[model samples]
Target: MTSNGTSIPVTADGIPRPGGAGSLAGRTVSRIGYGAMQLERLRTDRAAAVALVRRAVELGVDHFDTAQFYGDGFVNEVLREALAATRDAVVVTKVGATPDPGGPLPLRLAQRPEELRASVEDNLRSLGTDRLAVVNLRRADTGPGLRAEGDQVVGLDDQLAVLTALRDQGSIGAIGLSSVTADGLRRALPAGIVCVQNSYSLVSRDDEDLLRLCTDEGIAWVPYFPLGGAFPGMPKVSDEPAVHAAAREIGGTPAQVGLAWLLHHAPNVLLIPGTADAGHLADNLAAGGLAPDGEGLAALDAVPSRSADDVRLG
Candidate 1:
């Protein structure tokens, strides 16, 4: 039943699998896709990161997420090299904020109409693609937590108008929002919102309400921090008893159970677990078939939910 030799079982469609399809691009992506944020030298060694991405494809991960801010272009380049020959893989990249050319930096907003167009062109060039599959407009906020409700500096209407124009011009396939609030999503949903990439994980469920909104509106709720906030000291995958217990019962790994929980919780939920290890990459794709029902789902739901992490960049 597995397609592409990855652990993900094939659905009726010829694609590898199917997740929640709230938008056009997500609808096009296979379920159990890979997220490529951590596959860069900024966080880990470059060689290992590149291997992780190539291994993800070998394991049948057809959806890859990236942002221009990730290593300021390093992550996207890694993805281009990884899946350039894969026939069905989809790449989702972000626009709006571009980081400075160095370490531990702050994000600067870069989404004036012309800048927005140029950013898309830059992403296409850096990723070595003709057109982007999905383009999310990231908001840069000066806040302490991951989901801060700061004053609206970049008018949401203006941003959506630009995205709509790009979509019309076929520069990108679909549009999404990242690091945004429920109110912010409500404002942008009218302009063909496809997905909302917020910081949600077993530890961080502050955006549960937004997840519900995505479900109600038929949009994919793509959780960025599926394991935890992206930090070295973040809790180990085995720390969540629900994940560990599920893994013990299903004969899979804790990381797989963590991702499976997200998959089983909501059909509209899409997970993008990032890694820097090739073996971990293949192991992650295997988790998709470790179906957890009844007590397993209940156990995952019982895990204590923490407030939004203090990390600003999600």
Candidate 2:
């Protein structure tokens, strides 16, 4: 059924296939969603990027993860155009950093209370929507990205207060967080967070406690870098021998197996694996069907988390 209770066709939920249904932002979304970070690579070919996003929707991708700083708004612009003709897609975007196209990291902290608000508005303007579906406040308290500096440092409660007010005023739909710690999530729980975007993967279990916390609270755990390999020294699931063995056992690619393990690991987990290429996008969505057998799961489970990647997957 669609959100309004109309019966939907099998094509409407293609990749999720009904059995793969999951919840996010208080709505039903396909278990496998599309992330837009990699869209940055397609900035020069706007038409192809827009087509990829629409193609994702055609393939039943209802949940979308994006950030304003992505491609310094180029990615968001691609989404704005791609989504203009669609309806009822859960478009989630993150703030707390602005793009520095020429910088080494390509982003700078924009985490002050007002800076957060500005980023949300920038997203709205770029997406051409009055209200954002969800606005994830990316904090610098943890790793995998830039950290907050002197004045950029702001209290979590203060940040939530602003986002909460936006929800009340109808500027955004719900609240979310990225690159946050367990304690930070706990402190912001009262504000009604609908999902979390920490860096987690099969080879990175440092945030297992936080994943459990979200599951217990019924909050969605939308992990970034679900396959690992986001940064150097971070353990990539592709590099783990156990993951390879599990992939062979399950008859799926190592990347697909890594994603399958996440879905199997927790019910609240929603994958937003991003890809610029059509083939990779298909593989990501198809991961929804790659269930690991008990032996596969155990082999994957026994693989230890690398402490070095603990440097980031907070």
TM-score of 1: 0.82
Name the runs in model 2 displaced over 4 angstroms. 1-19, 308-314
How well does model 2 score by local distance difference test?
0.83
- For model 1, the superposed segments whose C-alpha errors exceed 4 Å read 1-26, 42-51, 101-114, 140-152, 231-238
| Candidate 1 lDDT over residue span 1-314, tens digit each | 11113343543234345332223454555557777766654355666666777666665566788876777788888777767677766788888766755434445567566667788888988899777888988764321233213332557788778888888988888899887778888888778788888767766677788888988998887877687745544444467766777777877777777777777777787777777666676677666666666777778888887665455433
Per-residue error for 32 in candidate 1, Å, reads 1.4
- TM-score versus the correct structure, for each prediction: 0.82, 0.92
Clashing pairs in 1: 22-219
Native-to-model Cα distance after best TM-score fit, residue 269 in candidate 2, in Å:
0.3
Q: Of the candidates shown, which would achieve the greatest TM-score relative to the real structure?
A: 2
Instruction: Put down candidate 2 lDDT per residue, 1-314, tens digits, no spaces.
Output: 00112233343444433227788888888878889999999988999999999999888888889988899889989999998877678899988889876665778888788998899899999888999989999887764656666898899898998999999999999999988889999998889999998888888778888889999999999988888887777889999888777766656788988888898899999999999999999888777766666666788889898643335321
